[model samples]
Target: MIFTGKGFRFGDNVDTDQILPSQYLVLPSIKEMSKHAMEPLLKDFSDKFKSGDILVADHNFGCGSSREQAPAVLKELGVQVIIAKDFARIFFRNCINIGILLIELKEADDFQDGDVISIDTVKSIIINKNKTYTFTPLSNFLKNIISKGGLVNYFSAKK
Candidate 1:
């Protein structure tokens, strides 16, 4: 997916707690969970995102406890893409496992807040205004998983 909009910039070490506040965990549905995503970073984050908007963040995102709900909450909220330097192991896998497009930027500092970006997942390229940087594309296996709406669907389709 190509993203061309102002970024909602966040800093390093943005933990799962910040993404999904514990107070909201009492609820079960992802729709309910989304109300609290990025609670600690932006006071009005829930209302701030547009359908095609991208979340730009620093290194080591989703570093707290293992809560699959974190990325699920993001997906339900229509966060099409996430660009970060590095991601916590569980969180990274959880995101891909659930079909939330997550991109790892080798040079996280290449873009800044409000810099328009376009991510061509097919080409594994990240374009910022006039420049483009390409990385290894996602394997076809992963693509199939994403296209089928996560692992469960992918597996069910195989049967």
Candidate 2:
């Protein structure tokens, strides 16, 4: 997948709770869930975000809680790519497990808020303005798993 969208920039240690505040859990659907997405960091973020926008952040992104709902909310808000300097292990896996593309880059901090970015998910390359950076691509096998909608689907298809 090639990501084409505006960028939303943030600093380090963005935890799952901030992504989907606990207060919003009562909502049943991602559509409703998105209304409260990013409530802690950016006021009016939900209404301001455009579909297909990319989220760029510094290290330890999604550092707290093993909440699958975090990714679900971001996906619901139409976040196409999440580029970070580092990701919490569970959150990184959760993104792939749920089909939200997550990537790690050394210079993730360089991206500014509202900068447009184009990501080549397969190549793991990101282009921000005139600069281009390459990230380690997910292995083909892992890509296949994500493409098929996670490990369960990968295994089920073998049955």
Candidate 3:
């Protein structure tokens, strides 16, 4: 499992509401709320973001609320993965539950918006230009869940 995309950078302590505001959560579905993703932080996020783009952030990304809407909306927006210094425990689990990859890399500061980055999961390294940062490798169980597009899909496939 590898992910590659242009990075979209954010600061520390980005919460669930900021990713997909609480008001949008009242909307019909994740697809509907996805249009408002990162709206509070960047008004033009939905308009400018492209599919497959990666989100890079500082420590404690997704620091508030365990609402699955956050990651669900992000997945709807085509965010395949997010790389951050660290993550809120519940948010980290939520991301994986919904099939988005989350990587922990303490040197996240080196990235800039639009910088091209590629993540090699098997190697546990994130590459940017000529620089590379190593991360803790994911367990095969976790990799299988993500590769199958989340828990539901993983279970369904076995039947």
Candidate 4:
């Protein structure tokens, strides 16, 4: 799928707790927890974030506990994709499981907060301003999973 959105820049090692603080994990649902996404770093992140926005960060983007709520909260907050230098292994899989596209790019600095970006998955490139960054495209199986809105949806459709 192709995605176009404004970038929300963040730094390195943004752990899961920072994404959705542990305290807020007590909340009943993803929607409730999403209201506090990036609260520790950007207090008004969710309020300022528009649907289909993108998150760009440095290495170890998701570096804490394997709290599935983290990615879920981001998706709930309308994050269409995340571009990071690298990701915590579990965090990477969790995002895919939840259908949030994750792109690995060592040159994420070009994406400043509020910069308009376009991700062409079919072409495996990200365009920000006049520059273009390329990444390996996810395999067709994973793409199918994401296209169906996550693993559960993918299997459900098969049935």
In lDDT terms, which candidate is top? 4
CA lDDT for candidate 3: 0.88
Candidate that beats the other on lDDT, 1 or 4, i.e. the better one: 4
lDDT of 4 by residue, 35-149 (tens): 9998999998989999998999999999989999999988888887999999999998898888889888989987799899999988899999989889987788888899898
RMSD for each model, in Å, please?
1.7, 1.5, 1.6, 1.4
Residue-level lDDT of model 3, residues 62-157, one tens digit each, is 988989989887887788889999999999888887888888888898999999999887788889988989999668888888889888998898
Clash counts per candidate, in order, are 0, 0, 0, 0
Winner of 2 and 4 under TM-score: 4
Q: How close is candidate 3 to the true structure, as a TM-score?
A: 0.92
Tell me the spans in candidate 3 whose CA falls farther than 4 Å from its real position.
Answer: 157-159
Stretches of candidate 4 off by over 4 Å are 157-159
- Give candidate 4's TM-score: 0.93
Measured with C-alpha atoms, the lDDT of residue 85 in candidate 4 is 90
Residue-wise C-alpha lDDT for candidate 2, range 1-159, written one tens digit per residue: 687888899988999999998888888788898888899999888999998998999989998999888988898888767888999999988888877878889998779998989988767788988899999987887788888877678778878
- Which is superior by TM-score, 1 or 2? 2
Candidate order by lDDT, highest to lowest? 4, 3, 2, 1
- lDDT at position 76, candidate 1: 85
List where candidate 2 sits over 4 angstroms from the true fold.
none
Taking the tens digit of each residue's C-alpha lDDT, what string does model 1 give over 36-152?
A: 789888877878876677888889999998988888888887877888887888898888789887788877677787777788877788888689887665678877888888888
lDDT of each: 0.82, 0.87, 0.88, 0.90
Pairs clashing in candidate 4? none
**140 Cα displacement, candidate 3 (Å):** 3.2
